[model samples]
Target: MMERTALISVNDLNIDVALRQAALGDRVLDLTPKGFDLLLFLAMNRGLVFNRKQLLEKVWGYDYAGDTRTVDVHIRWLRKKIEADPGKPKRILTVRSVGYKLEG
Candidate 1:
């Protein structure tokens, strides 16, 4: 039997990640495909730090040839949609020069 995956919610922000549906809430936001994938990756591994390269390989596919800035851009986009204050993000956070971690 195949196990089913349920939605993952970050209740503090009233956000839900519907993995099978590839959506953030009751409806999908205007996030790009990559943005959704990036958010999904972080949400699935909440609180775990992942560097740009790791994210690219895991989320964007190992054959992806983009630079780390791509990850930054997607993270920025995610913040805008999910954060109450994008400037002072309370969810996804930077680790100086290391990378990022998702925290609710």
Candidate 2:
């Protein structure tokens, strides 16, 4: 198995994969299991857009039967937690008519 980095940094945010933790500066951000997974996925594949279907499959798994709207909801939740201003997100960006990607 390929070795994985224990920690990932996106801008000022810090993610510790082994502990499944996310922090910003001196504050540790509380993220739900799926929310952390979503953030990790995007942080891992920064700049690469993944449509709702792809996000659902990758994050929620192939066995998941939820609709694409689930991804939207999760993204909204994530932005609220991570973004300085959720209304104009700078990290998780929406690719119109396409998908979403993380930018640090």
Candidate 3:
């Protein structure tokens, strides 16, 4: 069996990405594969600024030839689940015109 590498903990939430298990404040969060990947990438690189192109290359594992709207959509979805207030996000934050960063 392969060892699971992605381990994430946020407050009461503990998620094992390899096993696809997420516990959020005593409740289990249902996350899609893409969502899980995105969250794991940001959490692992906490406090680092990653532009859309970088995210596309790293997370998607190649240059995304598709629309960049995909990044925005996933970010929105991630914020909805992770942020206490998506409008005023304290975790995943937008860097104005630069990119997005995971706030530490």
How do these models rank on TM-score, best leading? 2, 3, 1
TM-score, cand. 1 vs. native: 0.79
Give Cα distance to truth, residue 23, candidate 2, Å: 0.6
Q: For candidate 2, give the lDDT.
A: 0.94
Task: Determine which window of 10 residues in candidate 2 has minimal summed lDDT.
Answer: 2-11
Alpha-carbon RMSD to native, per candidate: 3.3, 3.0, 2.7
lDDT string for model 2 (1-104, tens) is 99776999988989999999999897898899999999999999999999999999999999998688999999999999988999999999999999999998
Q: Give the best candidate by TM-score.
A: 2
Candidate number with greatest lDDT: 2
Model 3 TM: 0.83
What are the runs in model 2 whose C-alpha is more than 4 Å off? 1-5
* 2 or 3, greater by lDDT: 2
Clashes of each: 0, 0, 0
Tens-digit lDDT track for model 1 on 1-104? 98665666664433345443344445456777677678777878888899999999999998998687888888998888877799998888998878998895
